[model samples]
Target: MAKQYVRKKEEVLQTTVTSIRHNEYYNMQKMFDELYEKSSKNESFESLMPIILSKENILLAYRNIKTNGGSITPGTDKISIKDLKSLSSEEIIENVRHIVTGKRGYNPRAVRRKDIPKPNGETRPLGIPCMWDRLIQQCIKQVMEPICEAKFSNHSYGFRPGRSTENAIAELEKYNVYSNLHYVIEFDIKGFFDNVDHKKLIKQIWALGIHDKQLIYVIKQILSAPIMLPNGEKIRPLKGTPQGGIISPLLANIVLNELDHWIESQWENNPVAYKYSVRMNKNGSENKGSGYRAMKKTKLKEMYIVRYADDFRIVCRNKKDSVNIKIAVTKWLKDRLNLDISEEKTKIVNIEKQYCDFLGFKIGLKHKRGKFVTESHVADKNLARETEKLKKQIKRIAHPADDKDAATQTYRYNSMVMGMQNYYQHASHVNKDFAIVAWKINDLLLHELKPSRQKGRLARKGRELTPMEKERYGKSKTIRYDSMTGIPIYPIGYVQTKAPSNFKRGKTPYTEEGRKMMHKDLSINTTLMHELMKQTVHGSIEYADNRISLFSAQHGKCAITGVEFRDVNEIHCHHKIPKSQGGTDEYQNLMLVLNEVHILLHATSNETIQKYSELLQLDPKQKVKLNKYRKLIGLETI
Candidate 1:
């Protein structure tokens, strides 16, 4: 009243309850019925939803308007036909516009939805698509299909759409096409999950006409789903975002199937349709020049899909096929699904002779040679020299404490031998390089024993030598016995040492009380000597008389011929019946004779001895001659 006496009427915008009410329930019921029918036909859940929602624009618009708000006002007021006819066209248009703009009622407020916060405190709403990832996935899926078809048949192993890219690359190289292809195109889908067009995906699935409970579950997940984190944070994954999730593999598989189908369709009408038939040529030796001879036509049927999670590798017969496949896939994604491709990361290369790295493996052709060639540089020369020096040092020591210590010191040597053997075995089934040379030093020392003094005519009295001289002489004569054997020994080059003997005697040098003080000192010397002796006399014989080689034919006259040839210094014992002729070394077989005569008698035939010596050489006849000789020499014989 203070500003003006008259004021223009204010218009208010308002919404009736009926305007907010939706036919969503009815539409959803219809969809459910269709899905049920599809399910009855055994269609998959992913292939059922799109058909039901194809004409439900009203429902979608309602959802969008509810969440984003709009200016449409709802009312039941009626206008008379006479009033409408009285109004001009401009007035009617203005009135209709006002109604549509909601100028006559209270405006409704937009619904506010809570956003999930990331680790960095950034908030994001669910159901957004990532533009970059979609492009990459499309690109990869397009590139791989033709190559797979060419390399493998429908019945081949790993023919699924989700086959490993590495395997696909290898199969291509096996066909000898990878090297000719120089440029490689790689594709990656950026933010695939965040950018997914759920509606489009549903349409695609529905177009397939499959229906199942799984589809319902997927739909529920697509709407109002929550992802729980270890840190107690909850998030809702966006529709097209590709990331870690239980449903990721399934979704990725779905995408791959679509891409595979698209690629196959494109190839059906292409100029390279003939090339697809060449897969049959994979059989026979004639295909060797093309690298397909080893591959069986039957076996080639199974290599279609190559998938490693979200990454894809599409195989094609030629570069043109690869590029065309990419273009077709890109068009399908962009025109049908509103997705984009990332060209920067997409590359095409020839992987025929070399390996194509995928999922941490370098996969390439399976050559007839089938050998792996590495491109790493040889080991440093300094390191090799150092290793060789260490090997020499290890070779010098014969015995080590344990195998572990020995292995540590001689690692290079052992590795060399084993590696050579392994290499040969791999190359030719023979292990000729496994030879090892073992060496040991055997030091043999010799010593001689000299009598302390001379006897009889050879005796030298006062000249027996003093203690000091004796000590000097003993030391001079004290040849160091073999370190191995107690007897005088000599080294004969390098020989393996014998295992130490078990003396079997419990001998201790120290007294019970003194044991504690001298135990170690006394035991060491004895143990060392025992060990040396054990090693030295390991094969030699021992006797009490110390007269080694007691039996000798050197003395011409035998002991039995002593009395008969008393003046003769040479003598030998004779056997009436030679030992070789069943004779024994008993008194009856004993006879004395000159060395020459004994030899002569032995040289005579056994028949001669039996006929002549047996009678003429009888004990009494031999005793009479022996007595005459003995009397002349002042000796008695019997």
Candidate 2:
């Protein structure tokens, strides 16, 4: 028995040794593959294939980085953007060239990952790409974007350049112009990006006209390279591209476009009809004023299958056609692409009889006045999802102590809310239902801006404090502003503007000195705040959105002056009763005026200003400010 046990132990030891040797051989094979790739550099352009990954391409890539936020994280190499930017232009070029050419073996160093929550309460792993890796990927993407854009079908909008959900929505809405009995089938691929079969994806790309051997070699090497996880364990992905990589979206689009082409081919023999009617002016052509004129009769059957990334919507004539197409598509996906259909999500519904939720819109036909009109409204689930995200962002922005930063946050918050509203604005319930919700959110945000009532106030002993004492108390006291729900907080400052209304906020004139003082007081950082404050009013998003609506409604012409607002700076909002005269903040009493007209009204006497104000149909208040410029320029009151 002892002899048998010893023999068994020896056998186990031999097996372990063999396994270790096998792994070593496998790792060495990866190195050999890279070496072979390097050796092929001497080959002709015909053999090597030209690509944007070369040294000459780094300039445009660098420019894009600089134009972008230029944000970067310390990777495994411990290199950050600051370190990269510190180098001379020539040195930066050399460094990028070496990295792309794989002087050192290319392996992406992954950062700590956090799971992002989905609307369905499930979480998916999200990896942060190293800065160096991102730069390299960005360079590659610059090369690929235009090529993909030209080749990709206009119907496939997901992750492509200049395409958005709204674009896809607009394309889909084209069918809605006419009342047609269409069966809607929408589905998604299960774990689309995460479970992508690399070999199949590459093959599809090759079939789609990518014959570049060098690019292919680089892709294969990167895909095969081992990635270091957050826990410091290095593991190679078996299949599928990681989500964080910049090239992932482009590659995914390339693969999906093949699927789109195949589906299109299948529908050619049996085309489905999409009917719509556009309202034409008395002229022969469409009316330019009405952006997308409601049509009387239009047919668009070319887009039977509309795709945006993994989300797909197929319009068919009947249940039989829908089921047949779904089966064919699902079978092809499983058999050829090795991708699974999201069974629970894949469904067909008669949209004419019942509403089907597609890409956050509840789409159906509404019968009114003996006509069936296609109607789409914001889905309750999508609105709830967006609102939840907005709440979290608001909580984060509200926590900072600086009022300017808080204002900047408010601007961002309002922009996000407006973006949502833009998509849902055409919905029937938006004005009545969503508007109330938006107002309540604004009230909540305004309440946050006010000093927190939760903190204790300082009081004097046995006496009511005088105005002087109260002023001193206010100046001396400091209260801590705790962030809500433990959201991350950062101080953000508003971008100081030189608009005519800037003077109205305080006592200073809208001059260079006043602008400098405003900048100093706010501690404005132009680099950080410039893009964030574009089209915003003093960093107020709500104010900017309101102004935009008024500008559009009034057709870029001043209501009072009848002058075209060629520049946004020339436009101004005036109150019927000045705030100094105890006017309330009401929309009905507000009027749009030219900047010059506003200054003229404020500088002149109440009697003089009232004459023209009445002519302009404005309720002129008995409030005026003596203008120093009026006397300097010898200007008379209107």
Candidate 3:
């Protein structure tokens, strides 16, 4: 038989004496003598071991002394352990004093007496020797022991083995690899940490033969340690520690595995074969008469506990089977370990049809055709609304200057409009169109102070004034006020004493270059109208020169009606002509119209003009008339 390496208590005491002597400390002789005597009494030498080992330098010196024995002499030029141990108390005290005061040729290993420099370069005394180290030692005694004791029954379960099983199940489900229809169930154990039974844990630790001192220290650390939350709240662990810690999952899995074993033994004795079998087919064809035929049935022959730190997933089959299993597990934990489930955190959800979110992974049902659906479709209507509102607000605040703001607003508006156009692509419940419209309105407000490109002159010429336009033109420009603060801003320029002749004659303001300049001064008022009518008309006279070239691209024709123009200058871009007639400055509303015909159409009622415009179907009356003339020459029409 191999020799048993028994460590005697007396040997430990001797080791301590040797360690103290090697440090060349004189006053410790009495302390060493007292420790030896205490060890002989057999009255708990373990309690004093930590105090003796507390000084790192002394321990290191003792180790050196033990390693190099007789080769070291007492009082030779070289200092040695024998010299330290053989010296009288008075002699050793004197040497210690000399070393401390740096009088006996300064020992480099001795604690330096230099002042600690402040941040500002000023020096101060090195306060209290290793105060934190001493406190840590004391804290270790009070904390680590109790924690270890409470955690005695805990064991670690590595991820390698568990992940292999999970992956196997997934692959088997993929190729219909298993003969049986695969079913997975997941359950949560609530209030796991807070309900840990400290007393039971301590008893288990004692059963393992761990000393009381170590157990006490571990328990104290668990009780005293504080956890900081993301919201700045500090939480102290109550029953058990958080599951996110490195060792928590393994420990929790081991405890739950024990509970599972106990439950299985009980079920076997009771012989609830019918219940177990029924659970397996709860959602299967066997339950056709149970008013749940649409749901597939599954058998529950087994259960497993999967743990990621504190989060526990109890996977099983059949509702009744799962419920019974949960009840048994809960009871076992409560009776034996005093652990309770957190009802609020615990949830029972369909593992296959809907996803179960556990340990940051989402697991869901697999289709009969072998497609695995792992993601849950979560519709957060409020969140979407808030996000859209924030986006609009950000766009508004990002570029507030009127000139720069206009393009940004237009871009946002166009993007929203496009989304509405593609609204069918989104889920029916999303309200994508509504969101887009809301964003459009926000864009309008952001660019309220900006100017718009003027419509071509010909399209506006000869257009009659509507009652709304008359009122708008007649009303004096009032000082605009801030919507939020209600602070008024003075108008930049004075309103003209006389209305322009272009307004009276039904001619577009773009008839003369000088008139275009005058209109630029009035852009603040006309720009809003221009944007509103952009949905209907092509030309705006407010800022015409810059836009004239673009209008000529389509030969000054109405894009929708295919109305062509003979005199390019005579074809003016119309707002589908709405200053306020429920029209907006969108491309769909814009059309090229003959200047005179446009004026005539506006002079007529909207219903009457719409009828005529629809009849011609060409660019304007001039184009239609010209076509009729050509046909007459060709003998095609009268």
Candidate 2 per-residue lDDT, tens place, 428-503, comes to: 4555445555555545455664446764111122122223223322232221222321111111111111111111
TM-score of 1: 0.29
> How many clashes (backbone N, Cα, C below 3 Å) per candidate?
74, 10, 62
Cα lDDT for residue 464, model 2?
28
- 1-638 in candidate 1: lDDT tens per residue? 01011111000000111111122222433343343344435454443323322333223222223222111221112222333445553454344333223444312111122345542356543221121111122222222222222222221212222122223334433333322332233455554545667666655544544343433443434333444443445556445532422233344445445655555443332233344334333222122222232232322311122444445555555566567656665677677666677777555544544444433233343334564322111113322332344345334222334433332322233223222221122211121111112112111100011123522111112122223223322333222231111222111111221111111111111112222222222111111111112221111123200111111111212333322221111234455565566766554445546543454444435654454343234466555654454343333333
Q: Whole-model Cα lDDT per candidate? A: 0.32, 0.51, 0.36
**Candidate 3 lDDT tens digits, 64-100:** 3334322243211234455455654345434433433
Error of 1 at 355 (Å): 5.2
Q: Which stretches of candidate 1 lie over 4 Å from their true place?
A: 1-172, 175-184, 213-218, 222-224, 228-235, 241-244, 268-305, 316-328, 352-355, 363-638
Candidate 3's error at 435, in angstroms?
A: 17
Error of 2 at 154 (Å): 2.2
- As a whole number from 0 to 100, the lDDT of residue 534 in candidate 3 is 27
Error of 1 at 289 (Å): 18
Best by lDDT: 2
